[model samples]
Target: MAHQGFPRGLRILTAGEYRHVFDNASFKVHGKGLLALACPNTLGHARVGLVFSKKNVRRAVDRNRLKRLTRESIRLGQHRLPAVDIVVLSKRGAGELDNDTVQRQLHGMWRRLEQEAKRHLAATQSIA
Candidate 1:
């Protein structure tokens, strides 16, 4: 089946909530962006929070813009992903890219994320 974008039910907020998903992270590379993931199980569905830290990119506006881009991209391509508490952090120049460019990069990241989720689901099923 084809992947659909992230749904409203999969959004994470608050400092405490952020820590919940950021506790443990996995590092992956896809296209021009870096995909960071944290798989903390939630009550019903997954909540995702994308972080573009100021320390990594510098400037508040840039950080916010990149975060917005990452969130939208995830929302636009969350179908293939399983229930995951994910966080996608931007590297250098992520803020410099245009919306179209960011979209393309995010699409590629989603592909990797889909594969990762499949692996995770398989492992989980084995455990159960």
Candidate 2:
């Protein structure tokens, strides 16, 4: 089957949606590394957001590159996530890092997200 990325049915596209993710969810993935958090979207498919702060990286080119890497990581990992919207923010260190570094960090976070979603799915299945 072809890979479906960020399907229309699963996008959370509003400021309110982003704020809700930040406000209600607790971070799930933290390590000698990156952190991951997921807030199930009332909206349909999963979305992603990357925040690269200029204060940390200083170069617009670097910031955008980091964002691109983050997106690719999510695209590769999309199937593992729940049918919810998502936003992946880039920390200050993001811009300073290379694309490979950002990609590794993001995929690591996505792995945790996948595991958590699996657990949630199992709980739902058992309850139903």
Candidate 3:
């Protein structure tokens, strides 16, 4: 079995890092109650940042739950993902979704990011 750990380097720990993804995103996608923003990276591996706002999810417990779900989903699928910096933001309805639904949505979103990042990278390489 592969080590599926969310290491510090694989996390967007700084505000600047998160801002970079948000400001220079290559692709953005929306699902049930989640929004995913992605930007291709030169790191050769994927990194992730998550946002669960108090305005979107009123309860602290709900926010933590969403973050845990997001991190777990990313950890499981990180190996198959392209080299990209991804930021996932929760919306108002995200708290209402069940664990299974959140996981399913997150999985689908990661898959979409994979496809989009591939295309974006190819296009950039062709131009350079």
Candidates' TM-scores?
Answer: 0.70, 0.73, 0.90
Off by over 4 Å in 1: 1-9, 26-33
lDDT (0 to 1) per candidate = 0.68, 0.63, 0.87
Error of 2 at 109 (Å): 1.4
Count clashing pairs, candidate 3: 0
TM-score of candidate 1 versus the correct structure, residues matched by position: 0.70
lDDT of 3: 0.87
Per-residue lDDT tens digits for candidate 3, residues 62-122, read: 8999999998987765538888888999988788999999988988888887788778778
What lDDT would candidate 1 get against the real structure?
Answer: 0.68
Per-residue CA lDDT of model 1 for 1-128, tens digit only, reads 77766665777767786676667554354556455666646554557777776666777887777767777766656555556777777777666677788778777766776677777778879999
Candidate 1: residue 108 lDDT (0-100):
77
- Per-candidate clashes come to 3, 8, 0
Better of 2 and 3 by lDDT: 3
- Candidate 2 to truth, TM: 0.73
Q: CA shift at 28, candidate 1, in angstroms?
A: 4.2
Runs in model 3 deviating more than 4 A are: 1-5
Candidate ranking under TM-score, highest first, comes to: 3, 2, 1
Which regions in candidate 2 have their CA more than 4 angstroms from the true location? 1-12, 31-34, 42-44, 76-79, 124-128
